[model samples]
Target: MESARIPFTERYHATQHGGIARAANSSVTCKTAAGRTATPCAAVQQGGAGANGHYRMAYIDVDSDARTANSSSATLRIPAGSRVSYARLYWGGSLRGSGQKAAKDNGRVLLAEPGGRYRQVRADTMTGHRPHSATEGFQASAEVTELVRNSGGGAYTVAQINMATGHSTAGVWGGWTLVAAYENKKQPLRRIALWDGFQSLGADRRELSVRLPGLRIPANSHGLAGVVAYDGDRGHGNDTLTVRAGQHRAHTVRDTANPANDVMNSTVTDLGRPTMRWPAYRNTLGFDSDVFDITPALRSGGDRLTFRFTTTRNPGYLLGALFVQTDTRR
Candidate 1:
């Protein structure tokens, strides 16, 4: 289900990851790379190389404490003196290894603020889900406005995400996203919106578009756009995310980390650079949480902004969310 819009006056930021490769049987074994060691998921790309000269990629729990269930951390950067308007936590992955009753428990997760301990958080509304299959799967989310408001920006950890450990043909993948909108009087007036759902882009649907209407934009305006999707293979062509302001020409969104032709290529970054997160991965295997600046496209302003996501390939992709913050007239 789609979420209700915020006031449309806030700016936002986020943090996320592609899950870690489980090295052993225990969920604890997968967390050796947390906190202290800047272990890039690249180091453990495969269980070990084989005669075929190929490596297998998988996922594991990345929580800091093995004694606990599951967890992973990411840095949420917010400017000082800004108040958090709204914050939402999103977690999803392949359900095969996510264990029993994943659908029932998908609504609840444990979250720890910077310099804090874990606490229960529940989804206030909808969850996008699908049974374990050859394609990517479900996503669950909860509002964390108060938790993050007080915690402020830093390293925030999420536990009990219900993502599976190990690998498969579909791939063992999972991750978390914390989207926070803030009120910074010091910043420019902008239209910030977050649109989300669990939808496929293979056989069933080839494209999905999210529209934001009744907007005031300035000429040569600048802004940012981002998406959270799954099951996209790196180097896959014909997958693109395009944005257009009203009747203006549509511009394909891309960055150094994401190519113009392959927006779903699995990776996590801020405008193309790697972000700080445990089990940090340069290649998310089949998961993606990427952002792109849409400045050039907004040069000719209009009243409505439409974002079109298209993926023309096999095995498909699952979309979780899309966030946009564009410059606007006061």
Candidate 2:
């Protein structure tokens, strides 16, 4: 844990370009409660795939075509008249349940853009994998900006994620998110920044602080934050995300759909609807692709903003992505 924790580093950073949108879905499914709370439900209905404390889990095979071993599709919606400037796909899970053979298969996957055939894609960026008891969590990503720029937006399916499917001491979990930043002259000038790495939540570093520069916040500006992480429990409590304008006091970003104490709980959330996905599960069992408002935390006229993610007394989590979008001076 010490070795894996000390080296929390960066994977991808956008040099330039686009508004932000994400298409995400869980690769695994399990039986759980109805309302999708941390509280255990005795009813144990067949719910969408997510990180739950109870029930057996399995891979989600939404792609009946079945040219690959495992596959799932998610919807990436870019507004009309917008061109994609950047896109990255992230996927991983516990290799322990699937046996160590998958360790060699890390960073390799299949991605199919809307109306296109399957193409091999590898994690051209950082690959984060660490061991914790019986569960070894790993996350890998690949840049698909070119594919996305040409293909536009729709249901994008990813296959061969190479994650385990079943109940484990740590709970079987894996998923993918297609995050794209677009350019639309019709929209307000905005800054879209993305940062990713294999950073630990509690093992060695309890906090992740990212400083983003060259942002201008005007009055009545809209802001958003997005994240991808692994192994976060449903109600482990004490997890928080905070953001601050340069030289200003920090404010904890809050949302009704997301609990401050459990920011990493499994789920893929967007702004209340237009939720297009193949298997839109409220809980992803262990994977998380969450979005929340940071507009309340913004201050006018800043060249930089700092983003922080911290855990006080929760089990470990490996953060894979951090994205920020805000209106800026063109």
Candidate 3:
């Protein structure tokens, strides 16, 4: 039987190698010299080296507990006037637990958002990690435009990344500002999930919503919040998304909507970084792909809202947070 494809928001299950590499959201790959790191120079070329010589490049993966490693602090240059919007962390790890509680401690890996400089993004404390009751598991972290942290351990190949200027949904009028080292590899893309009741404006039974896939937003720095709804196993609804803006009380819950729904504990700081727990189990927490309604006290086109709409969802689950925007810059 064909497995049912849930909402447009979905998590990826990358196959593992061994030891720490087996953990969820963990991955590793080999690249050329110029392609050795996150932001590769577009002018530079990669060829002459033998199989052994081409095996030097490594992209490290790190999560909450492992963000302080030496590998996470690599440096690079971001064109002086480059305006960074979003940063994504590609995680590769093992998911071999059963039932909801089995993967509770090791659910998802969360990377920290960029502060003044680009730092790694982590999962919410309550949702990211589930206890490692299972056997061998690993976790890895990827950097965005080289500004974010790149912890060593579970380095995976960079599937696709375009850091051109301006948020061009058209993809026709911009230069490749930052290119992934593993652009050639078949890396899993990020997934966007949505929910009702969590926003302030309330769900729109009529209009559909959508946004750019893998786009970055500041951690708690006031941007658009996207949402999606499965609506009881009826496939997907309109791609349209409705974002609600305002001061709404936010809380975390598990994938399933049961009393035992897994809860994620998180808090956004002034610096806009959220320290969250990695979810060990698998649920659709960050698996929606469309709109995010508010918790009942706000509206959509108001002051608390920022961010413009993008077009599609790449593939896997993306770990990050959303905030109310005081201004408009999308």
Candidate 4:
């Protein structure tokens, strides 16, 4: 089969203009587990010389309609048979308060879905904590690929906030942003590609392999396409990278110049100097880009599909990210 080029398209969604308060009203008041509630932005001083400090807390409720009734919802609707390649949440905002030193607080944003399913989208110990007295700015983000996949095209009812501490001195205010990338075409149920986050590969961990999760393929897939971004190589000679499925050897990856033996129409991109170094190497090295096809070895056996890789030399190549495209039976 001819090689296929899979391109990714991206879109961003965000809440209405103005702060979180304007987006949705605080329906539920903040209360401690012991049923203790403090006035909003009211500083509670702590006693003792060693404990020379104070904190505050408050709770805000983000209305479902207000949060999703914006341009971001445009990509929420996934075409039938198509899948989301990637989804992430980018959130940032300023906190209002009055204090000599900037107040610090930890909070969580909950994504409340239908059927009573609640997922904590963002959780951090220090958010919106600044040193300035009048106000402080902070930001937090997370990858929600799995969350988007599980949503099943249902809308999130609300983005709930939970303040663990320092709520009184600083009132939480921010906007929620959603960014998603989807496949352009409606892929068949059998043909799908799951992106696995960056996998670290080194001399100690030479072979990097991952099994496709939550996939039920009764028979062998028609073809397999694999794309990887790698950096930090130590070797100069031509090193061969092998792709395998179970015990079957699929494709051997080498310099893209040798296209005669390359069946996947593999391509490479050279990403100059290494910004960072792995433990094995103390100095920076060049990086390599690879995109290839491994259809020959992508057969299903024992109800599991696993991809493995091994290099001829210790290039010290760190596998940045991997995406596997294959066809399975419906």
**Candidate 4 C-alpha lDDT tens digits along 1-330:** 101111221122111111100011111222222123422211211111110012232223333344432111111345555455566553433344222222232234555543445556653212323333222333344567677756644444335332122333323223333434455444434434434333333444556555554444444554433333322222233334455555454455433332323211112221111111111111111212233445455554223445555444442333323444445443
lDDT by residue (146-204, candidate 1, tens digit) is: 98889878887777766565434455566778887777777777777777767777776
Model 2 clash count equals 6
Q: Which residue runs of candidate 4 sit more than 4 Å off their true CA positions? A: 1-85, 88-186, 191-200, 213-220, 232-239, 246-250, 253-285, 299-302, 312-315
Better of 1 and 3 by lDDT: 1
Largest TM-score belongs to which candidate?
2
**For model 2, which pairs clash?**
50-283, 50-284, 50-285, 51-284, 51-285, 51-286
Per-residue lDDT tens digits for candidate 3, residues 295-326, read 22222323332222221322112222222212
Model 2 spans with C-alpha error above 4 angstroms: 1-18, 31-53, 98-101, 131-133, 272-274
In terms of lDDT, which candidate is stronger, 3 or 4?
4
User: How high is each candidate's TM-score?
Assistant: 0.81, 0.87, 0.23, 0.35
- Taking the candidates one at a time, how many backbone clashes does each contain? 1, 6, 86, 7
Total clashes for model 1? 1
- TM-score between candidate 4 and the true structure: 0.35
Compared with the true structure, model 1 gives a TM-score of 0.81
Query: For all the candidates, what are their Cα RMSDs to the real structure?
Result: 7.7, 3.8, 19.3, 19.4
Model 2 residue 102 distance off true place after TM-score fit, in angstroms = 2.6
Report, for every candidate in turn, its global Cα lDDT versus the true structure. 0.65, 0.72, 0.22, 0.34
